[model samples]
Target: MFNITQWSLKHWLAAALLVFFALFPLSGDLFYTSLLNRMIVMAIAVASLNLILGYGGMISLGHAAFIGIGAYSVGIPAYYDIYNGWLHLALALIGCGLFAFVTGAISLRTRGVHFIMITMAFSQMAFFAFVSIEEYGGDDGLVVNGRSEFFPFGDIENNVTLYYVSFIVLVAVLYLVYRLVNSRFGGVIQGAKANERRMRAIGHNTYKYQLTCYVISGMMCGLAGALMANFSNFISPDMMGWVRSGELIFMVILGGSGTLFGPLFGTGLYLLLEEFLSRSALYTFVTENIAFLNDAQPWVYWQLPFGILLILVVLYARGGVDGFLSRWGSKNG
Candidate 1:
């Protein structure tokens, strides 16, 4: 849909990454492919949060609850011997939209830290609610018996098939969000973020715009959750934990909160950094070599470096990774 001449560096990078991933499965490296698959799923979740947080300025910390809902839609259904892919997806979307509608209506009434705290409280409510359900494994978690099946030819049990499906979903989400942020509804949401009182003064129902945006965001995140459950073959209260929400927030901000494709970059960066820190032999060697770190577990201190990087980004780069890339062109990705 985009013209080549108008494309920026970030645009080119996005295209290149897509090409890479499309061909990555052909290499037959299951480990990295699965890792990238997980990245694809998290990227979708991050993008959903970006819709409300970046454009609508909702700053919700409860988005992970929606993800949990989507996962449970799949897990619970599978528990009852229902393995229909379309049904799971339908449930995920419906559940997330309903929860977002009810919660968003109430949460939107507040502002600033109150909004964040209230959302977090709601997320914890969902987390514990699931934890209390022993029949579904509760705190231990629920297992997905099999991958979803959409058609006779559509089998998600194969990693390659799932990767392509996730990739297509990622592309569709990007295009949909791009169209949304540039549309009339997007303008109203952004306008509300800028000045709600003025938007209301001009006859716009700011609350409606924000709540609708929130619901749409939740639905999209629920889709990601469905994919995630398929990928991990498991679901738990931990998926809805506030910490996961915080991590999603970190990804959005790190990649450029308000811009297109920011979530992809942010999530990719966050996961890659975590992967490195979590399994880096270099860290082990350095820690063992350095006397001061000899007694310290190398993996235990990954956050120190990560925290410092985040601080640096916050201090020096307001637009995040995508924003930094935007500097190369007049267009924002």
Candidate 2:
């Protein structure tokens, strides 16, 4: 039995968020619900990346490749008419873990810009591999005709049901990460991140620790990928693109890399801004008010504002939104 007496404000806030998410579906707006579902999935993916980039001090620009692997794990099996949810998820976790093990073995040997370039190269290789799979729609992508079967629970076709499932997984992952970061192994990895030379001098096998962390992160992201495939009911090579990897990195940084809930905040904020900018009335206003802009799509420039926001976050909130909030809280307290 877990004791509730030791729970702090952070724990309470997490509970409140879960409660809010649980009830959000009652609003009955399918569009918003769908957006929230994507946000939850992206939150998991970004958090997994944060595990390596923030805690382990490993920079991987190919993280999305593992996600793409996971997506294909589901898509490929389902292409053969296999639709078991458990099986798809297991395949995703195992496949991504193996891929991470191999890639991490090679990539972890390098550091700095070389490491970044190597990861990006691996990701590009993965992207090309997926594109070469002509039977699976190749560059066009594959559509899942039906949702994965969960036996007693059935398939997750219901938007509300899917939302709850995603929310539960997100909460579980957050808790798992929180516990992992406080464990002895986590301490060793964090120490290695701070100074690998010192860790090695003290008898720690820094490479092994980092590799283990990388694999764990990959598996976690793989799970997110499985969820994403189900959520979108599609898988494409684009999922493995370097652009997606960059977005994941940005989400982790924007949310405050080292914080447990930072990735969630960052994912939600980034996606929300993207959605708003792409669909907002401001785009219509710009096209209507400016004659020269009428011929071009105004929404295409949504990145302009998003890029500006990113710059502002980097300049002022170096620790990300989470860090800024923490500072504000401490100051007021």
User: Deviation in angstroms for 92 in model 1?
Assistant: 0.4
Candidate 2: residue 53 lDDT (0-100): 91
lDDT of each: 0.91, 0.87
Model 1: residues >4 Å from true position, as ranges? 286-299, 328-333
lDDT of 1 at 156: 94
31, model 1: CA deviation in Å?
1.0
**Model 1: per-residue Cα lDDT over 1-333, one tens digit each:** 389987788888878888887799899999999999999999999999999998889999988998899999989999998989999999999999999999999999999999999999999999999999999998999889898889766769888899999999988898889999999999999999999899999999888889999999999999999999999999999999999999999999999998888998899989999988756776667777889888886667777777887899878877999888877555534
Per-candidate RMSD, Å: 2.2, 2.1
